[model samples]
Target: MQVKQVETETEQKQAYHVRNTVFVEEQKVPAELEIDELEKEAIHFVGYEDEIPVAASRLRFVDPYGKLERICVLKEYRGRSFGSQIIKAMEAAIREHGFQKSKLNAQTHAEDFYQSLGYQTVSGEFMDAGIPHVTMVKEL
Candidate 1:
């Protein structure tokens, strides 16, 4: 499994498809929220397994915080560390770009996953995309 940073339009499209499958279709995330206008400025990364796109995520600046969003991996590839790899990719990008901190609104079910990645719960649970979510952050 190779974690590749997407630098071209083709890789960007592949990353979008990964997000659409994991977030829009699988998680039932609204099309409006999942499809945002921030893609143009967001830093994106795509993970490939044997030349096939399998997981992805992106980073964006929201004032003092570096927001990591659109993190998703194919269902068949979930048991592996694709999600972790994508998170690391996003973290590296944020650090390279000189960010003070990072944050992510993680689905409630995935809190443990993010926490394991050094993100701590900073706010009470809330509903996003009609699903329970919590705001978590990691000081960079």
Candidate 2:
């Protein structure tokens, strides 16, 4: 298993495919919410378990500080820490981009997971793409 920076067009497609499989196909998130127009600018990542993409995410540096968003893992890879691996890789990428802080809107159920990674909640829970979410931030 490896976490790689998605560099080519094919890898980019695989990343989006994995995200769609988990968030759009399985979770019922609107296709619009799963695929965004900002993909072109965001730094993307894909986790491959022996060439099989099992997880993915994107770093959208929309603000002065980067924003981690669109993180998803295939169902079979859940509970195996692939999600955590993705986040760590994304954070390193954020640091490489010279940002000292990053933020994300974590789904309510996964708040503890992000908290375990040293992210602290910054806002009350709210709804996003039909899922409850709260803003979280991490200082690099």
Over 4 Å off, model 2 = none
TM-score of each: 0.93, 0.96
RMSD of 2: 0.9
lDDT of 2 by residue, 7-100 (tens): 9999999999999998989989999877878888888999999889999999988666789998899998899989999999998989998899
lDDT of each: 0.88, 0.91
TM-score, cand. 1 vs. native: 0.93
Error of 2 at 45 (Å): 0.3
Lowest summed-lDDT stretch of 10 residues in model 1?
88-97
Indicate the TM-score of model 2.
0.96
Top candidate on TM-score is: 2
For candidate 2, give the lDDT of residue 10: 97
Q: What is the lDDT of residue 86 in candidate 1?
A: 83
Deviation in Å, model 2, residue 65 alpha carbon: 1.4
